[model samples]
Target: MKAMKRSTLATLINATLFSAVAGTSFSTLAEEAQAKSNQLEVIQITARKRVENAQEVPVSVSALQGDNLDAYSSAGMDIRFMNAKIPSLSVESSFGRTFPRFYVRGLGNTDFDLNASQPVSLVVDEVVQENPILKGFPVFDIARIEVLRGPQGTLFGRNTPAGLVKFDSVKPSQEFDGYAAVSYGSNSSIDFEGAAGTGLTDKISTRVSVLVQDKPDYIDVKAPGFEKEDSLGGYNEMAARVQFLYEGDDFTGLLNYHVRDLDGRPIAFRANLIEKGSNNINPLYDNDVVYHDAASRSTQEVDTQGLSLKLEWDLKEHTITSISGWESAEIYSRADVDGGYGNDFAPTMGPGFIPFSSETADAIPEHDQYTQELRLSSNFTGDFNYQVGLFLFEEDLTIESYSFDTGTYDEAAGNYGLQNGYAVQEQETSAWALFGSFDYSVSEQLDVTLGLRYSDDEKDFYAKRTDNPTPWNGSPDFLEGRANPSDSHVSWDLSATYKLTDDVNLFGRLANGFRAPSVQGRILFGDVVTVAESETTNSIEFGVKSDVLDGQGRVNATVFYFQMDDQQLTAVGGGSNFNRLINADKTTGYGFELDTEWVLTDELNATFNLSYNKTELEDDTLAVAVCAQCTVTDPTYTIQGPNGPEARAILDGNSLPHAPEWISNATLRYTKELEGGEFFVYTDLSYRSEIDFFLYESIEFKGEALFEAGVRAGYAWNSGDNDYEVSAFVRNLFDEQVVIGGVDFNNNTGMLNEERFVGAEFKVKFF
Candidate 1:
């Protein structure tokens, strides 16, 4: 009865997708898998712009899909589901499910601004989602997710020095198909998602997919002097996608459109969650309760739409392809920045020194992004093949930032509980790139490939501050500030693969990539716009891939070293309400990764992944401002800051912020034949070492190691080539809770990881 009641909404939503059930593009993906004489299936990837065996690819790549992907995203989880699942990869976000920040090989950006640039990029259906907002598109009906590690600039364009994540959706097919999935979990979490597709005609096919997620606020908020409305830990999000494919004698075209709507809360910055002198959580930190005094705070909303078209023409021995895309989004979010109400000015302030009350709102009123690419590839059955492409991109964005008073109210002067400061920033960006990849097979055991890309990037940026904080003394207003940054660079990579045996391969790769110049115009608190110059990286890696124990086990290992010149860095939240862009003279990183999979028995399987990364700045004269409260571990010296002589930490050899030293993951699956079906159990675990939240080393800002585990069990059976499944899942099995990020500008504020959740899921697919 409970299952039926929980699945009712999903049934209705799926019915809206059409009269068909939900899945199959993933199960029947490869026409020719080339599997060995074993139970394990062959893995396929598009790491080098071509579908090939994973072992044959020279670059380090990992893929997650099928039931595994479903298990992680059972309870309306966002894209952060990929965190710590693969070697050398981490995902975190301060904006909840809106903008996920990805780090590959310990290289990433930590700026929380709307216009921040990332070292890692995201590509959906071969079109780059360059903007941070677009990168959070709901994950549904995705056929496969590939993570290409290391420098991918030669083929993926700029802002890819760390790597890139690619998501490929299931395209329209001639046969009629559909699937529906639903899960009801703790926190009143409901995940309803499904897809439907069918052939309208012999030459035309279409597919539609939709997703809906909702959760109620479960935390209690106690405000002593004010009325509190919406609590934290709740959200309602919906997304839809539609695609049409047209196939001709020698041509094919595909058009896609998608939209997203989300209503959620901002990150709850727990004031003084971390102790002033230690890394551990303070005694006042409570997972299920909050002590916010701010009235009517915490509101967030986001809306986005995108459309793309792809066309391809097949010549006798060559192919030409074109892709065009456009995207736009708007968002408004307001939150109590200090995590509480009543500043030090009031005698009732608790939770540490309270400092001062800080409340702010950020909005993106206008945003537009356009991209186009043209490519030509050779399909000759010879030793040599090549692919070349030309890409163009443009974007225009506007940001509105406001500060509000959270203390006493003065209706006449609008002092407290009203708007205090306001600022607006606008930016326009244009970029173009020409990229090519060439491959040659010298023999049956040796293959070599080369890639090159030339990119020209530029940005036009301006910011203005119109209002100053009236509740307290603030920086003077500034206007008419302009910053135009531009640059051009050529990225290249060379790789080779040597077949050591029928089931083993050794590969080596050398690549150089660069992130384009970025401008920071977040002048809501600061008076000037800062720009970080182009940062480039040169990396080399060697690896071995092998299928052992009669193809029942697989192991892949890699060792890499890299050095970067003029590395871009962002100093955020160090007793300041601004993000400062800086460039390190030199930086270096080295790492090793190992991935292993084994079929212990016909009824059991296991997989493990591990990575160790060490990154450091090499400059001798690099220093940054230090936090006001934390116990500094680095040597501090006074420097002339915006105020006066301020303490600066010597960060010449400090590891990158949020870059963990070790990460590991493991999974185990067991199955047993049941009456007319199969009963299976799956469990997964991930762990990451401690990390510093800023350039300077401090005790309070360091995030301790975290380990999380999950389990899912279910029974599944087939009906006339169709599939049906019902499962019960538990995430964060141990109820692990730890701080994931920090707000250093204010007290010992900290953000936490996801909470424990339990749910039931059911899925139906028909063909």
Candidate 2:
């Protein structure tokens, strides 16, 4: 039985990391160790938005304070557990929890076509979340999370040619702290989170946080008399924030407000590829079907709201700042594709099958977004710095799908009417930017930094087709009219740092980036309306940061090289379903990253992260015309003669779908501060080496090397100054069922992979 359930999940993750280090030495020696030297203070931030010392931020960033998010919530902290401990992050999703796809280094955009546009860009505090369903927004009370990488377009603007992910919360602080946690383990898992604040006077203060999680589905919903069998998916979150601060005199004002709501029901797994074997197939499968129903039951809802304002002045030489923001989001979803019998063979020979009694349902298509930004920054005496920005965005998307035909018998047009007419799109964007950066200190071990940015972009789109209830008129099915394009760009960056001593430092960077050209709703259902150009990149980097030993240990390394032009690839076009966002002709990528942390004593601590990526297609006639059309064609028919040009010449030179050319992540953490509150053990490993889910790579997907290890044990309580802690956690451990994502697009005729899950977790904190 799966090796006795993987030896009972590796003995419950080493007995929950040795009972959370023996309940932290029996609650910090029964509360009397003088709060362990004030919890060994030394956590600082600013991640370059100003304020320094996140290790002197000269770029290459990564921070995850807030008690390391409570020890990664017992080893499961979204974004695929921080992309397995961060090393060039990567995330993939195909409509599960409402689309998620992120990548850095190898860039990103798997083009699941929901209006494709994502080159790594997501900011929270400085607000900028160009709707990708808010990038799966979920992470609470975070006081930091940087991950800057490269090409931040001179300072984050435009689609950020591959870099940027910032989220900072936990503001309003005048004293009164906050913390609250709840957790339950094993299958019926549950988790609750909380936060609070005080200081409602002395210039106002407020903080609120909330998170809720539920677990139950892992597959097996046999219908009939439904009696459960792992039905997979669950998550919910609610948030709120408010703050106001003033310290007049030379002026300093701050105001903020935020709200968020998220609901999720995730579970989508499919893989039976006609019983495995097709060049060693194992897209994850555990089957038992009589008629057919692969499985997928989804629900996602998101609501976000924001407002921010800040102003500061302290002309003691020169200092000024201003930032303003507005944000909005709304999303709704529904998905139910119990594949079994292909939903009864798409109402007998597709072309718009609509059947599936029990009142068919497949919603999913309602999105709205709005954004605004304004910024002004300056700092004169201390080596010049400047910023200027303005941006606006809007979106309105819609999708309405209906299916039915539960085996014959209709009573007056009732089996189904709207097979699929698809329409509803609106996009508008505006931008303006001007940035500056300068730092020069020739002595004291050389220092040089220079930056610049200039951007101007505009886009407009519109589509319509409220409903067309079957009649087959073809041609002019949608997209009445609308398109306005405009673009202008300029990006730059330069850096040089040398301090080979002082614990080491040697940096180098040369950058340039750009991205602008997006119009949603599949250009109003094809027929050439393609306008989506502007993609450029040029980067070269070198880095090294050290603190080896004297500071207990720390190491960082980076190496990069990128060259792209006109590159805006998105394939899948051989008459299967339609999608093609072209512009490839030159491409190249090189990478290497290494991270280290070691305190290997004083109770021991260790950490390591690694990344290696290689991308190509440096022109070979645009990689054989992007691998000859790269499979995907069926925009309502069009194929005749010579097998339609040999299926577009089998999309020549293919390879670029979910671009994964050996990606790696590693983690090894250990902490033992027993005496009352501390004892942690961790292991997170990730490896991805097979990719090409389509884009003419004609179905060739493979995946493996996935591991998750965990352990946590805690207990703490300090009376005299009030503080509390409690813990217990267990995750995956060894319930390894692997396969985090899958695709068989052309092969197996479509859709495949995703399944296997195991759970257990518990946490508590009060301070």
Alpha-carbon shift of residue 228 in model 1 (angstroms)? 5.2
RMSD of 1: 9.7
The stretch of ten residues in a row with the least summed lDDT in candidate 1 is 18-27
Candidate 2 minimal-lDDT segment of 10 residues: 350-359
- RMSD to native for every prediction? 9.7, 24.5
Residue-level lDDT tens digits of model 1 in 1-767: 01223353453334222211111121122224444444567888887777899978999888887767777765688999998988899998888888889999999989888999999999999888877888888888998899998999988899999999999998999999999999999977899999999999999999999999998776666656653434787889999999999999999999999999999877677878888789888777667666676535677899999999999999969999899999998999888777765668887875777888888888999999999999999998999999999999999999899887777575875445677789898999999999999999999999999999999999999888888664243466655568999999999999999987776788999999999999887777777689999999999998877776566777777778898899999888676667889999988887777777877787899988888788888887888877767889998888677666778788888889889978899999999999999999999999999988889899888899989999999999998968999999999999998999888776777888988889999998989
lDDT of each: 0.84, 0.56
Clashes by residue pair, model 1: 21-178, 21-179, 22-178, 22-179, 22-180, 23-179
Off by over 4 Å in 1: 1-38, 227-230, 408-416, 470-474
Candidate 2 residue lDDT tens string, 147-174: 7777788767778887887878777666
Give model 1's TM-score versus the native structure.
0.93
